[model samples]
Every structure is written in C-alpha cells, then in structure tokens.
Target: MMRKVFSIIIFVFMLSIISTAYAKKVNKEINVVISVDKNRVEIGNHIRLTVGVEGAFDTDIPELSVPESFSLMYGPSVSTQTTIINNVVKVFRGFMYGFSPSENGKFEIGPVTLKYKGKRYTSNSINIEVVERTPFESTIDEGTDRSGKRVDINKMVFVELVTDKAEAYIYEEIIQSFKLYFQKGLPIDDLDYVAASTKSFLAEKLGDERRYEEVRDGILYNVIELRTALFPLVSGKIEIPPAKFKCNIIIRQQRNRGSMFEEFMGGGGRRYPVERSTEPVKLLIKQLPEVDKPEDFAGAVGKYTMDVLAKPAKVKIGDPITLSINIRGEGNIQTIGEPLLAPDGMNNFKDYDYETKVTITDRGDGIRGEKLFHKVIEPQSEDVDFIPGISFSYFDPDIETYKTLTHEPVPIEIEHSDIETPIRLSLESAGLAKGKVKILTKDILPLMTDLYSFKNQGVAIYKRPVLLSIIFLIPILIVVACVYVQRQRALLSNDVGYARKKHAMAHAQKHLSNARGLLQLDNPPEFYATLAGTILKHIADKLNVTSASVTSDNIYDILEKRGVSNEVIKGLRQCLESCDYGRFSSGQLSREQMESTLETAEKVIVQLEKQL
Candidate 1:
C-alpha cells in the first residue's frame, strides 16, 4: 500500500513538470508545421496558411499566428481532429489562416509561435514572394490603378486587356480578353463591368474563371484569367474602353517582427481598396470590300454549314409546322442572322423570324460552334404546297469573300378538307354582327361623262415637238445615269485599291477629327504624330501605296510626275518637316500653331486631289 501511494506521488510530480513554463522536454509534444498552396502570390490573390499542430497528446491545443506581411482573413478556424491507428491515438489541431500579402518582394512568414499549457513552441519559417504582377508579365504599373483606398506596395493585382488581332475587317470575329490576374487565394469582394452597349462591338465572355500557376521572372504566381471576345460593330478605328474593377483586399499593416499574436490577438489586419484597370485599346477595323460582296451576303462571317428541319412535312391549310434551321461553324456564330426560308422567290411562305440561339462551345483548339433557330409557321393559303428552301449568305473569313449556302426546300402535301370554316365579319364598335356571316356585292357600271361642262383653256404648249422631245429625253437620261451608277458600284465592289481611293478623303477627315480632340495636349509630340499619320494615310490611299512606302522623297516624285503645283509640293514638304521637328523638339508651341498645322494637312490633300 505504501509503494502504491509513492507511485501516485511520482505520477503527479511528472504531470506538474510537463506543464511547467520552462519544461526541458514536452511529452505531450505538438510540432507546428507551416504550409501554403504556393510560395509566390500576387497582392490581390490569397494563400492558405495552415499551422498544423500534430502530436500524441490528449489535450493542450496550441494557438498559432502568421508573419506581419500577410493579412490573415479567415481563421485560425480551429479544427481539433483525432484519429487512431494500430491501437495508437493521434491528435491534430489545424489552425488555417487565409491570408493575402500586401507587400511585394520576398517575405519570411515565420517563426510563428504557439502557446499551450504554460509552454511556447515556434514553427519553421516559410519564404514567399509577393509581386504586383506575374514574373512572366513585365507590364509597368500605371497610376490609373490607384483607388480611393490605400494600396500595399507588396500586394498588387491588375487586369490585362488583350486582343488577338491588331486589325480586323468590319464584322470579322476578333477576341478581346479581360483577365483579372490576381494572386491565388485572394478573395474578391465583387468584380463587375458595365455591359457594353449595342452601338459598339458585340462582347461575349469566352469562359469562366480559370486558375493556373505561372512563373514570371523566376517568381511563381497564381493566376485567374477571365476571357471575353469582342466583335467590332462599325468600320474605322474603334476604341475598346478600358475595363474597370473595384475590389477590397486585406492589408497586413506594418507591425513588429516578433510574435503574430499581437496582431490577431490585439488588432488584426485592415481591408484596403484594390481598384485597377487595363488601358483602353484602339482597334483598326477596315470596311469590308463592297466590290466582291455578294448581293445575298448578310454580313455573316466564318465557315458554316446549314440545314432546315420541319416536324411535320405535310400539313392541312392553317395547320402550324415547327421549323428548325441550324447553322454550325467556326467563327462568329453570334453574328449570323435569320435564314431566308423562302429563297425560291416564292410568296408561298409568310415571314417567319426569330432570334438565333447560339451555343458557343470552344473545342480545345478554337471556336467551333453552332446556332439554332426555331419558328412556327402556318400555311397561309391551301394553294401553297411546299416550303421553299431558303438561302443564307456569309462572308468566309478564310476565303476573304462571301459564300451562300442553301437549305433545300421542304415538301409539304396539302390535304383538301370540305369542311366549310365559318368566318366572322365585324363592323365598327357601333355596328357589329354577332354571328358569323358572309357579304356579297354586285359590280356597278360607271356614269356617263359630262363633256358640256368643260372648256379648253389654251392650245396646250406641251403638245409642241421640241417640248415633247425634251420631256421624253429626261427619263432616258435618268436610265443612262442609273446604268452608269451600277457600273461604278460594280467597279468599286471589285477593286480594293479603287475603293480605298474613293473613301480615302473621308477616312483622313475622320482621323483629323480625332486629332482635333488631342489638340488640348500641352505637349507637341502626340499632336504632330497624329497630324503626320493623317497626311501619310491620305497620301497612301490616294496614290495606291502602302503607308510605309509613302516617305516624303517618294511622295515628291509621285506628286511631281502627276504635275502638282510646286507650291503645293512645297506645302507638303513643309507639313512633313513641321511634324518631324515638333515630334522631337521640347520647344514651346502654341495651340494655334498646331491648329495651323492641321489646316495645312487638310488643304494639301484637297489640292493634291484636284491636281492628281
């Protein structure tokens, strides 16, 4: 009995030693391990930091804290999980912290400490790199990204605006992607943009949020890419406005290096503003050539095949038939309009129209998708026997011209029914027939003319041969003028350079109008560059030359051979010289001087047009 009592005292003493503040060794040991999804992250992205406290203890769960650089968003969401294996019990207390780094460069998030049962334990430090952008992205940051809220220099995320093509023909399919690239794990409060208006290009999202890891400049960054496709509405230079986004990101305020406990236990991280944007992009969209445009081409672009289906091939008069017209292709399926179901030029079918329901499925390589149209139509008259095949025309971007596809007519056999369907005839609200009725009327002959009441005013000068010849000649002249117009249209439609020459003046004028808005620049470089571009483009279009080949030396030769006045040639030289000089010089120039330069460009083009 004395030995049993002595064993109990020893057991109690051991327990007391294990719980001491300066215990040499802890039998109920908990080794905290720090882990993250990634070692590198962006400011807007988040990382999951788990402080895993693993031990064979029955109790004594440790508390954890991260470094000062990371904004701990959620948790220390504590989970004290226990499991048994091989008759041995294990306990794991995971303290997970969702944090976003607010600073850039390398940060050591460690020596996180946990305190339990009067003892303190420290975890191994984790090294992480936080950057404004991916290592692969070298795009410089702009001031436009700053919002009203404070920004952490270490934590920066931004959006990227990219277009697949620098130039596109009118109605050509072009992809515009807006990617909100942030660090992985960063929580986005709300991300949104105003829906693009119908007056510009059509915009469609390519896919949902995509997450991946990319290494840029040797730094690994977690990324989320959002994609969109833009189809320009009109020709000329269309500006896709910059995408705007508003967000809130946690900021790990500056604090001491020792314990993470002070921040979480005292006053934790604050939420800061993270607003950023990509610069607006300008797309040079040229007009589709009218010369080779098919008369049937309805401005559809891409490669496509068409077919029409009707539920019931045969129907009685007034019975409805469900028709499905499908167009499947690679390219802008959304731009395809309704098919002309009555292409046989027969009035047999009524105008049945509907919106094209497009299913844009992006096959791993590119957009190979389909569009469907469903409509219900009834036979207007018993005489109509078959639904004529319809024609759909689209410009094949691959072939650089319009191609028409025809869906073969659907045959419908009519069944003649002797049933006399009652038709109701109603008068105005004041006089209406209650029951169905038919009205019958007989034709009446015209009354005799009263010739005695009319008197001749004159001999009728219009009856003379000369006046009659002039009057009769007018319509013939009009017919000839129409023929000439048709021929001109045909030529313009067929020749690309000829079309460019025709609209070159108008195009140059449009560019000048844009430069007019730029005249407010306090500097001279942009104004001169724009002014020079307008003149060069005009000359290229007029002379059927590429802009790159339209140097002043070559331009002089062209103008001189075309017999432009030396004075006009000199003015052209002066304009080019002024642009080059203003582009380089930091010299002060008045707004009036820039306006004068603009005038010189316009006047030079007008004179050259008349001369050459």
Candidate 2:
C-alpha cells in the first residue's frame, strides 16, 4: 500500500510539471501587420490594403485609420486561412480594403491597435502617394515610327464612365454607365468578361448593352455602353470604380529586323494586348431625410405609376387567378421590392405562391423603365367581389418629397362551381353481365368498344363528283410547287437581303426547335452557338450587311435609321447579348435558363419584325 501511494504522488508531480511546460510554450501575443499593394496610384486607381493578424481566432479587425484625404470605396474583403502540421496549428486572418484618392497628395495611414484575449497588438504606419490620372498608350497601327518604336493608341482609344445625375440622396436611384470608344474594330468578347462592380452601391443591371455612334471632337467612335441602376447604400461621397476591360485591342506590332522576311514568310498581322480599363467616376450622395418619411414606402426612390390587373376577369370560384402588378416610370424600378398593400387587399384569397416573378425593362430614356411582378392566388371568400386598391410609395429624388401612387381596384367575377366527384362504373351495370354468354379464352382478344368510327360509316365516297374532280387539281398543285421552289432559289442566289429577310423567321424557328432537343440532351456549348448565330445572322441579313460586319458597334445606328422602335431596339440588343452570354458563360446553366434564353431570342426577332 505504501508503494502504490508513492507511485500516485510521483504521477501527480509529473502531470503538474507538464501543465506548467505547456502553459509556458503557448504564445499568447498576436502579430498584426499592415501592407499596401501600391505606394502610388492614379487618381481613379484603387489602392489596396491588407491588414493581417497572426495567431488570432476570435479577434476583431484592426482599425485601418485611413487619413481624411482618402475615400474608402470598398472595404474589408475578408479572408481567412489555416494550416496545421505536427499538432501545431497556425491561423492567418486578413481584411482587404480598396481606397481611392480624393486629392493628389501623400498620406499616412496608421499605427492601428487591436486587442485579443487580454493581449494588445499594434501595426506599423504606412505611407501612400497619389497622382493625377494618366492616359494609357493610346494609338497603335500596323506601322512602326522612325524611333523604331510602335505608336501607342493613347487618346485615340479610351474608356469613360458617364452618369446623368451628379448628386443623389442615400438609397436614391442613379444611372451609372461605362462607355468604350474606339476608332477601329475590336474583338469585344475579350471585354465581355469586364463587368461593373457595384461595391459602393446596391445595383440592378439594366438589360443588354447599347451600341451607337458618337462623333466626339471630330472623331467618329464606335461606342459600347454598359449601364446599371445604382442606389447608394450609405450616405457619403462614392467613387465608382472603373470597369477593367480585357480584350485583344488591335495594336501595331513593332517590326523587328526580320519584319520584311517574316511578312514574306506569311506572318503579317497586328499584335493585341489582353486588358484595358476606363476612368473611375465620383458621385455625391447626401443622407436621406429622417423626418416626414411615409410608412408605406418600401425603399422606392423613383417616379412611378402602378397598375393592378387580374387574369381572366370572369372566373369560377375554385379557379386560380394570376394577379399582375406593373409599375412604370423613371428611376430604380427593379429595386422596388414587394409593394405595400393594405391589410384588406386580397384578403379573400387563401392560396398564394411563395414566389414572385419580377421583370424589368429599360425604356429608351436612359434608366427610366418598367417593372412587372406576378402573383397567383385562389379566391376563398364568397362575399368579396373585388380586390382593394393597392398603393406604392416612393421618395422622388427629383421632387425631393414623398409621393404615393395608387392603383384602382380590380373587379373579379366569381361563379359558383359544382363540386365534382368521379363515379366509378359498377361491373354489373356497365354492360359486363356476369352470366351473359361470355367466354374466357387465352387466344381470343377482347373486342374494342368502337372498332369503326360511326360518324363517317356508310358515306358514299365513290359516287361524289367532287372526289372525281380532286385528281385534276393535283397536277396544277405540283406545277405551282415546282415554280415556287425555282423562284425562291433564284431570289436567294441573287438578293441576299431579300432572301435573308424572307427566311429569317423560318430559320429562327428551326434553330429554336433544334435547341429544344439539344437542351434535353444537355448540350450547352453547341446550343448557345446555334442560338447566337440565328440572331446575328438574321439581323445581318435584315440590314443587308455581311455577318462579319454585323457587330454590336453599328447596330443601334442602323436600327434607328431603319425606323425601329427604341423599345424594340433595346430588346433586340439585349436578346442578342443574352445569346452570346449563354454560349460563352463558363458556369453550367439549368434547363430553365436555357429555355428562357431561347424564348427571349424568339421574342426579340418577332418584335423586330413587328416594329419594322
């Protein structure tokens, strides 16, 4: 017993020693460091900063303590990584911020301090320099200069971001857009990946980019536009970042010493770069009023009118009714969420879908447009005859006041529907007599109820004079079919525009039908290609331009001259782009998406014909 007690005492002493050693080895101090991506940047360029903390799990991000002269465009793009080896785990947490210089100068950013688990840490200060925006190498041609250097396409080709309004209230709708101007043709697919980052604002992308001609400073430029409906998330001065475009812009390749020999060897072409960017823009967003705000306003910041409608005005009591709520006007139509309806409105309906179909359209007047919302409901109350008036409230940034738009009540006519219960046929009464001379045989088949259609039975077919005369019309029909084919072939061979215009509808339909089958087979790439070609080819033929020259750059001007409705023109442009995106998007899309894209393309083509 004494020996056992001595063993226990020694074990307890060793455990105490191990505990003290572990406590001494665990480092409690966290290391915090601040690093900047670049010390100097153009006025619109983003200066990135990373705040890193070591050995931290439950620690707050250290304050960046940026100087007053810088504008924080976006912040705290958070990232965390962890690694463990030999039972020792290491964790690194980082926060990234993008800042734009408000004025050209040198600035110092902080000795920021942070605390974690009763321990304090500090980061060293950082210095940043800002300079005025510089133009990129602007002009490049297929020729070399006397200095043996290629000319840069500096001012000749550049990008600019434009907006209609200079100032807005917080959460107010603003139209922000980017435009690329070029003197020569470019491969736009390279820039297709370029997208507007709405880091500083809540945004809804306006459908399809618009392309048009703008003669700026006596230079006719091919312009491509990308637009967004932006609402400031916070009240402050916001600097909208430039859209980084990466495309193989045709630049002049410098001719080396072997240029003449290489050209003779069939290597003659221009060199292209991989990326380009537009200048950033700034907008002043003032704080919205805290007082005199309406209760019904559901974050709407535009001038709009509301229209309420019920499908199938006359309906049986048990039938489902589709309710359409449409809002049209200027401002952020898509940003307007669920409309604020009175409690009594649609109280008679008990069944409703949990989802709503919301669609937005841009009416040629910049971002001013239309929004549609759909909801399905079934009537449950017998006494209610109509849906009550619904109201939508919005703060008009232009008027600087709150305005409420009300839609009139939609009347619903409900008729009593008789309850239906299917009655099963009784074996004894449904002509299957139990003992009526019936034979059960393995080889015999059951008789069909109507082996022959009685409606045409016993009609005199051979005696009719019209039947005898039908054969005489056959030869004439064959001759007419042959003549029509010959005429069509001749026209198709001679007049390209007429031939294309005539068969555009048929070709589009055939492509869509083919895509339906492809969708079932899960073929995305080929499906997108065929669909895009259908639209592009159709438009090219309609404009009498070769498919190679029928590009987005010159489409708007041509359509406008051809007297197409602006609305239809916009829809066509959006649909064409939708096809391109469907073909080129890297992510796998669902059957529904593929189907929707096909439908949009068809609608655009049909509408184009109508508008023409």
Candidate 3:
C-alpha cells in the first residue's frame, strides 16, 4: 500500500511538470511577419503586405495602426491554416493588407506590433520609396501570373463610351454603348455608374448581362456592356462627360507559394482580397452640321426612302384599310424617334392601329436593317377620301446633305356612295297652307285640341305592404331560432390524415408550377432550387414533420418507412444532389437534364402521395 501511494505521487508530479512546460512555451510564442514585393511606391499605386502570426494559443493579433504616408486601399483579409502531424496540431493565421502611398516620398510602413499570450511582438520596419508617376507610367505587374503572362491591369478596368454615329443632327438619335473589360483572371462583383450628361442624353442599362472567360492572349476577363439612346439637346459640339464607376475586382493569392502543392491538395489557391476600378474615361462628342439642312428634316441620319402601300385602293365604307408606311433605311434605324402622321386624310377614322417591325442581319460593310411601320385605319364616313402624298425627310450623311422623299398619293373609290340617301324637297308654294301659317305660342284661347288635358300634373301617395312585412318577419324568426337546440354532433370530425393529404397535394402542385416556370426559362440553378424546395416542403407537410427538422437523413428515413418505393427515393436523392451541386458548387446542368429533373420531381411527389 505504501509503494502504491508513492507511485501515485510521482505520476502527479510528472503531470504538473508537463503542464508547466506547455504554459511557458505558449507564453513565448508570439510572432508578426511583414513582407512586400518592392521597396518603392508611387502616387495612385498599391503595394501588398502580408502579416502572419506563427504561434498564439487562443489569441488574435493586435489591431494595426497604419502610417499617414500610406493609405489602406483594401484588407486586412484574414486566412487560417491548420496542420496535424504525428498528433500535433498547429494553426497559422495570415492577414493581407494593401497600401497605396498618398504622394511621392520616402515612407515607413510599420513596426506593426501584435500582442498574444501576454507578450508583444513587433515586425521589422520597411522603408518604401514612392516616386511621382510619369506621363507614361505603369503599375506593378505583380509578376507573371500562373500562365507566365502579364496584363496591363490599368487597361483591364476602364469605362468607354462608344457611339454608333459620332455626328448626329439635333433631333436625331445616336446609339451609345458603354463597355467594361477586365483583365485575365479578374472577377468583378458589381458596377456603379455616375455623372451622366443630364436630360440631354437618355442613358439606360441595356441588359443585366455579363460574361467571363479566358481570352486567346492568356488573360481571364469579364466584359459588361451598357447601352443608351443619346439625342443631342443642342446642335454644336456636345461633350459627353466622363462616367465614373466603382468596381470590385476579386484579388486572389497563392496558398502555399507554388503550383505543385496547390494542384495536389485541392487548395487551388483562393480569392483572398478585392481591388476596385481606379479611374474614369472621357469621350469627344460632335453634333451634326447645320449646313444645307432641310427645313422639314425629321432628324433622320441614314439613306432611306418612303413608300405607302394600301391593302385596298377601293373599298366600302366599313371595310378595313391597312396603310403600311415603309421607311427603308441604312443607318440609325433602331434609334428612330416616334413617327408622326398627318390626320387630315384619316378624318372620321374610328381606330388607328400601328405596329413597328425591325429586322437586322449581316449586309455588305456591316450589320444593317430595315424597319416597316404598318397602320390600320377604319373610316366611319361614306364620302370618298384621298390619302395625299406624304413627305419624309432624312439627313443623307454620305452626301453631307439632307433629302426629302415623297410617297405617292392613294385614291380610294367608295362603293357605298349611296349609303347617305338624299332627302326630297317639294316646292308646292301658294297653297291653302300659306294662309293658315300662324304662331301657336301667341297665347290664343284654348280650342277643342286642348279640351281633353285638364290637369296632368298632380301628386299622389301610396304605401307598399311588402317592405313592412319583411322588416317584421326577420326579427320574429331570430327569436324563434334562440329556443332551438343546435345539432352539435352532426359536424364531421376532422380527419388529420385527409387534411395532410389535402395540404400536401396543394403544396405539391405549387412546387410543380414553380419548377415548370423555372424550366421554361432554362435556368438550371433556379429550376433545381424550386424543384427541391417544393418536394421537401411537401414531404415535410405530409409526414407531419417541421420544416426545420427535415434533414436529408431524416427525410429519407421517413419516406422509406412510409413505404415509398426505392426508385422514387433514388430520384429524390438525385434531385437533391443536383440542387446542392448547382447551388453550392460549380456544376452546371444542361437544359435536357433540367427538364428531366423537373419531370422526375413531379413523379416522385406523386408517388409519395400514393404511399401516404
């Protein structure tokens, strides 16, 4: 017994020593690392710095105070790495910071300090030489990328205003498109545009569309396009001001310094930070010349001819007439303003209907198109009307002058000329009626014609018995029902299972509808999301389980116990997987796959309903 007591004391003492040693080691392990690619900086330029903490037990790095000469352009984004080897765990935390020098000078970037485990650690001071940017200066390339290529990062992000026609007349329309191009391997979050030319230009974002890909030059780029319809407010040189935009470009970093480990560990690097668009761009806009301008010019800028085509040159009064105004043009057809028509020829027309059709295709020099305007008119009068010749004026930019084209007049021969029957007027004067012509309102004495109407205006009163009877009977019936015994047990008891089935079927149809719409749009992500959400909600409702508790495992167990077929269960799992992948991962499903998934979901829901 004494020897056992001694052994226990020795073991306890050993444990205490081991714990003390660990405590000391933790107290001394505080680290801060600062690194940069260059010792120099410049105005409107950025330099990257990486701060790391090597060994801190349950402690975070202290907040850093940046110098006045440097501006913190971006993070301080943090990342952590953990390793377990031989049953020993080690965690390393890293923070990346970007600094842009405010002006050209010699700047000191720290003595950045960190306190951990009751100890303070300071990084080595770094002196950066900031130089003024020359007229032709380039930013740091950050070395050749993984593809051994460098892109002009400055040019990758810029705003450009492109006009289809630089010179357009005062009332003419110019198609202006704004485009943004990102460099290879660059991903941007969103774009915010400011500083428009006010009411002078009608600017609008054409479509919420974007595309990203690696170009032939080994640069990954994202391109966005915005369009606007610009009509010059004035006639002279109109300058389109620079449009400023703020774009968030994803900044990426290497995980383990090189490619071999990244490819092997599936680390594949990560987007560790972000950079924003830096500058705005300007465009020189010129207005069309007023020389030789036509007095009746309709602000057209292309070569065009006008033609009036009528369905029927001669028709009845009620017949419909389709008068097509065809303006075949070669330039700025899509930007044509609202067309106006003179209504003098269309008088008495009940309804005036018009439609515009534009077709574009590759023709000769570039893309060109023709637009046709069709107007349907219905005349209400019987008189024959004439559609006089219409004149269309357009600026012929090729010849540096304006020209007016006239459509030939069209005459309509109305077959219903006799629809208005003429009244006959008889001239049988000097008859016996001429001597008897007298005024009737001259207050003559009442004759035999007025003897029957003695008094036609007299007030009379009569009481109706129907309204009084209803008013007395409704309340007497209420008093009679107060003494009657209500049938308390006749109502059917609520069937919980039937209610569940009813709700399940209703919700299932809702899910099916959502999936159908998503499928029609060919959106795989939304299709799968709606499809999976609908099925899961229906199952939860049918099984009497709360939606929050409907995990994949829980759902599978419930469905299997409910005698759901293996095939249907398998399809449910497939749908869930597809949704998970398309939503959380980079897997994209084809249109056929989306349609199949939608159909399969419906079948599975129907089968589940059968089992229930």
In model 3, the runs with Cα more than 4 Å from the true position are 1-159, 164-168, 190-195, 204-220, 253-292, 315-324, 328-386, 414-612
Question: How would you encode candidate 3's per-residue C-alpha lDDT over 297-332 as one tens digit per residue?
Answer: 656776776767888877777778887877776665
lDDT computed for candidate 3: 0.61
lDDT by candidate, in order shown: 0.68, 0.69, 0.61
> Could you tell me the TM-score of candidate 3?
0.40
Where does candidate 3 have its weakest 10-residue lDDT segment? Answer: 485-494
- The lDDT leader among the candidates is 2
Inter-residue clash pairs, candidate 3: 184-219, 184-220, 185-220
Give candidate 3's total backbone clashes: 3
- Write model 1 residue lDDT over 81-120, tens digit each, in one string: 6543333446777767788778788887777777766677
Higher-TM-score candidate of 2 and 3: 3
How do the predictions measure up, each by TM-score? Answer: 0.40, 0.39, 0.40
Worst 10 residues of 1 by lDDT: 439-448
RMSD of 1: 25.3
